[model samples]
Target: MHVTAADGWRLPAGPVRRWTLRPAAVGEPVVLSVNQRNHLAGVVAGQPSVWLAADLPAGSVPGIEAPTDLLDGLLARHAALRTAVAPGDGTGAVLHAPDGLVWVEDDVVRAGTSSDATSAVRDLLDRACHPLAPGPPVAAALVGAGAAARFVLAGDHLVLDAWSVALLASELGTPRALPAAPAFPALAARWAAEPALPPDDARLHAWLAFLDGLDQALPTFPLDLGTAPGERFPQRTLVVPFLDAATVAALDDLGRPEGASAYAAVLLALGRAVRAQRDEPAATALPLLVPVGTRRTEEERATVGWCTTTVPLVVAATDDLRATGERLRAALALGSVPLDQVLGSLPRPLRRTRADVFMVSWIDYRRLPTVPAGTNHVSNVTEADDVQLWLSRTDAGVAVRARIPDHPPAVAVVTALLERWVAEVALLLR
Candidate 1:
């Protein structure tokens, strides 16, 4: 799902109500997947959650007066909701049973002006969405009244990853009808049972070399963010509508001739944009940590968990779309492995780098059911020192959002870099 900061979305005038997940039985000890452990590696002091806001279809808001059995059953079905993980270096996880597990009471929230309603919902989310909170880590709030309304689900990233949110849109359509899938704990246990790629495996070697080629550090914004190491600043969300439907179609048609794809075209554009901002040698490879999904079966895809991995992609500073496409294919072929495991293989210094170096998340909405036009995935506001670019392609077109350091210079440079990125994409029309 395409996610931006909460600022891009807010519900219209309406009464607010909340649905909280109430745990019933004592949780059972479970193993945390490497990815889960990595996400929960260090302690986060404040309210930590990933917010998802959906603009419902004509009948999407199943009920309004009180929590519906549909929703309750839906919550029980997904194991991710009941899985609890605490911050630590060890395998600390507990999966609460989902039978009579959650309770969503009709708690009325004060409604003010339209803006005020959004603020109240956000405040509720901040108060309720701790991963280690009572019951499940998720909480929901319904806004507006009538057949068509909006809802937001905020929870820890441990439960909802990028793919989970996308699948969530479909699940909301018919939660009970979703494919039967393994519990998140089962997935974690299965992963633990698999033999990890040996230290000398090709995939691990390629990943390690990727870090080494980049000055022995995770990839940084090619330009200066004007911050010292470990120094974080407020982040600015710059949403750039980079491509329209016809334009994206044109990108596809144009690249199709050389066995290239829109993804490679974007990489070509991004590589060009980065080189435009500063003088870099042609031999330089722009290192990016691209997320690789781990769901190999339909059962896994239908399940909710952090079933994703990351690999370092080195996009060369060249305009050849086919070559770029080949590199991307090769990078992904490095296979899916917990990003933490890969980082653990690095030198001590690189191991201690920011959790995100430079991450680029790309999702195409065609894979999901047709969601309402205004549907958006929202992220919690946290101090960000590293730049992460989210690229989402929907029926409307392609959109780019960047979480950049909030300093003026960083903002200006990122703004200009993205502007050039848009221009570069346009040059594809030629």
Candidate 2:
């Protein structure tokens, strides 16, 4: 296989070194968690590239000379990295722990001449972004030499989450016999048997009503992608560093007094931008998919798996920025119920397809305790069908990345939307 870089450089895909991780002792079969099941459903629904990748921080890199040896040691210590998925016997999917789990442990091909680190990392990440192989569902590679060296880890979202990536990076070399964390199987069983409390019921009902009120077909970005009906849409990403440090601080200060959050502000700006772009009526409600995490406890946070689901947030085009922010905060507060429970409560027709909704997800890299120093940036690449906007805080300031279908019209629509969002954000900050 050959991968062409964005700069028109072609990289020859070399043979990958593979390994099988064997469990020290055979254990009982583990059941798939609700989060894992959700990921499987996403894959079936056409969102195939549900993988996460991150650059290993300089401080976190192992002192060992060989990248393969370092990764082997890291995998041997982390049980979660050794996990895979298997078909259940007349039951649902089960978490498979093979005696020997196969994996793409390492891949390295020396360049004829010394290559710049940036180009090398870009090519390596392009390859890493591909779908995970059958068993183990994770792969790692090290490319370049000396100052230009880069370490990459790619994993199936079914078995890994953002928190898991940070944990793995932080604990790479320093192995310790910490107390065993609750595995996904145990969490799945607990969630299955647990009844929804009164609060959970309230959240579920609110979500159902929200979904019922939404149009059968929600408003989409105005773009004629020229795609055939029922054809799979290819996705393209556009990233822009919209906010500087001073502006971010100003926005934070402005929202602090009103109990508004950065996330609420972003959503409000997005809603306004979409309204302006489409010239929709003031009464029109724009539905935005917002992801909520299920790992509330310390123990749950330590465990690694897909523990998130997207809920609907309807933004009214008529509302003022403050009102919109307040309403969004309230809606999110009421949407604390687990996604699986919410789905089970909804009727078949009312349940929304995961891929059809527009999404706005925020990640604050500064808040992650396990994130190592010199961590430059982080981004998620998924082949989702809908327009997805990812907002994250990097060392520079606020960064926004939009993923839409890979067509000229779609790109133009998203580009205009992003520009309008930036302008709206500026107006709000003033």
Candidate 3:
């Protein structure tokens, strides 16, 4: 339980329950970091809690004293929020278990203020929803100063898959619905009890076997540390934009030539595009990481929490965009086929596969809820903070947290690339 100050406010001794959902296949092969994995699990299984920190402005009156009671009530309503791991059980192979409970300390956005009182209120309310350390299942941070609150959530890849974080964000600031969330134990039981169809089960089993077949051939992605001159160099970020409707349509059309979805086509196209950008030779191996949603039955879809596995699609860079797209589509068509069986097949390697970025990932959020379509539409709503990039690429997206120093004005470059990418796709579809 280490504590520190950020901006101006100090974090109080508060507890937050953060949930870590894992795929059943990874349950038996624990190989991730101990402090981040079991340490979190122990925290969740025993006492799920977190500390929050913030910096307050002097002379600015606190509009709402921190909602201590509301937060407590929230804890009471989400049982998973109250659980923690049994001691000595949070390390080594055990980390690969389906989920982990982390006790995070407040260490998100440091300095920043809102512009107006109303904005500040909204900002505070949002912060109240996130706990410090192991932060929220996703990434979260505050921007600007008092009265003009803007926040960011950088959800952990393992804990939040696309729409999951958005659902959690929808609950910020309000009193949590009562009766605590259903326990993970019950959820696990339901998963174990689900009836398995023989054919589908066999398909899944085969998928797992296939993944095992590629243990030695899958390409690994090196982390994108950025092209900086030296350590202690300024931080820079690439602003990536998402595809437009037309681009999506074009991708769909591209796939239709071979019976694949736009997403799968885009994945393949992007691989080719990236390879082209680097002037890589044909046959360059690019491993594409795609998160598979394995909540089989419709009933399981609404069950919140992470239930996804990262499956890598290794393809050789080719000169033909259509050829590359078809290859990707074909791979995905069969790649994500039997998710459970895939997990069960190569228990140990799957853990490594997740951390291996050797390629970027796709996170789709088209089906996410959107504030009921027309609830209190504030027409002139404006944010009183620096403009930020909101890049969307199919199912996955990432925001440029901050501009890196000593770079080629990356913000503009990245944003331009994103816009072009979306426009190109949209135009092609049209």
Candidate 4:
């Protein structure tokens, strides 16, 4: 949220320098998370990476000759960078990486203007930060110098989750003030060793029942997205204003009596919008892929790594708002078990058949650490078959962001869907 590079900051006029890093000593290889393995399963050569970019305020890095000075400390602080996933046929071990900016002068290119430099740095990240490959899973670059410096930190989902990306963005904007926590490689090893439940376990049985209910297919868009089977289209995003703070409070208040939350209310509204349009009068539940935060303790909260797992939430619709909310409350406990374990317990073919997953994730920044205003998340051009919805509640209010395949029909239909969702939510207030 600091003044941008354009506001009185200077872009480096000299030849822009570069630094590449390797691990000083190797750590033990760890198994990739199920999310990581699946995300890497899609990577191909020349794939534009999924990434995050930020603009650090003026004088954020005083006495620093280059952004590398800041990058070096960041590299040390977050160990997820040091674990590189070897690209093969979908499955591989995360090999230990050589330590920080130890290598100098990989190459330097000269750019005359800020725009040119920005493009060059972006390309650099796209090359270095590829996922499911035999190279660094993380890379960072900076444009401009001194007060006007901005950075682009790119990595695959394997090593960097949304929470990790947000924390990294905040750190780049401010100096490295947080204390060091446990390294990710060690934590990952311990996590990999955790015992999985047998097939007869109650949690496994509940998940199995849900999966059996899903049959073999995942939830598709209620309306056509104008794409062919397995066809990939460039991603597009739309951010639409949702409920205001007062409305959110009212919804929560209404649900509180039923031991339900505003989240459950919104889920019910989402289900109604989706099913009502599809004209499935008998449909009573909607299953959403939910990203559950896996950070086990407060100390691990600030540590930068992929501390999240994806689980399914079957949002059931009922006559009483109380019943729907209570159902959601009980379902959240299922996330405490790791998703890989759930998938591992299932038949292998079932996992391979599902693609272009339909997921809806909700994150409330108001509950976590404070972030500077104007600090936004950035992503890259990629192909997708389904629309992914992220509902984020900030101090400004609740807003739902949708990433859909960029097409005229999609824009039109999705606009209608969100509008309906808003209207459905408004009914709960009445």
Q: What's the residue-level lDDT of 25 in candidate 3?
A: 29
> Which pairs clash (backbone N, Cα, C closer than 3 Å) in model 2?
none
Q: What is the overall TM-score of model 1 with all chains considered together? A: 0.91
The TM-scores of all predictions, comma-separated, are 0.91, 0.80, 0.51, 0.84
Report the C-alpha lDDT of model 1 over 1-430, residue by residue, as the tens digit: 4556766656766777777777666778888877666555443433234544443442554443444565565566788877765335334877777674766665686676678777877776666665556556677777766754577666767777767666666666553455456777788788788766788788788888887877577777777777787777876788778788898899898889878889889888888778777765454468888887777886676777777777778887764888988888888887565455676777755643664468887888787555544567777666677789888998788899888878887788888888888888887667
**Each prediction's Cα lDDT score?**
0.71, 0.58, 0.36, 0.65
Question: What order do you get sorting by TM-score, best first?
Answer: 1, 4, 2, 3
lDDT of 2 by residue, 1-430 (tens): 0111123222223322223232343345566666666566655555554556445533357553565566555555445565654433222443444335434433344455433433454544444443233345566655444444445565666667666666666655344544555575576667667767564466677777776666333334333444444544656777677777777787778878777777677777777777787743443567767776667788776676666666677877666657777777766675456666665565665434334457777767666545555433343444545577767775567787677767677777788778988898898877
User: Against the correct fold, how does model 3 do in TM-score?
Assistant: 0.51
Q: What is the C-alpha local distance difference test score of candidate 1?
A: 0.71
The TM-score, computed over Cα atoms with residue i paired to residue i, of candidate 2 is: 0.80
Candidate 1 displacement at residue 184 in angstroms: 2.1
Q: In candidate 2, where is summed lDDT lowest over 10 consecutive residues? A: 1-10
| 1-430: candidate 4 lDDT, tens digit per residue | 2211111223444355554444444455577666666566656433344644443432443434566667766776777766676445555655553352253434666778866775666566556666644455566554555545545555656677667766776676665466665676666677778888776887677777777777745555656777777777767777767888888888889999888888889888887777666667577677767777878888787777777776667776554678777667666667767667776666643642324677787788776555445555555546666878878877666888787877888878788889988888888778
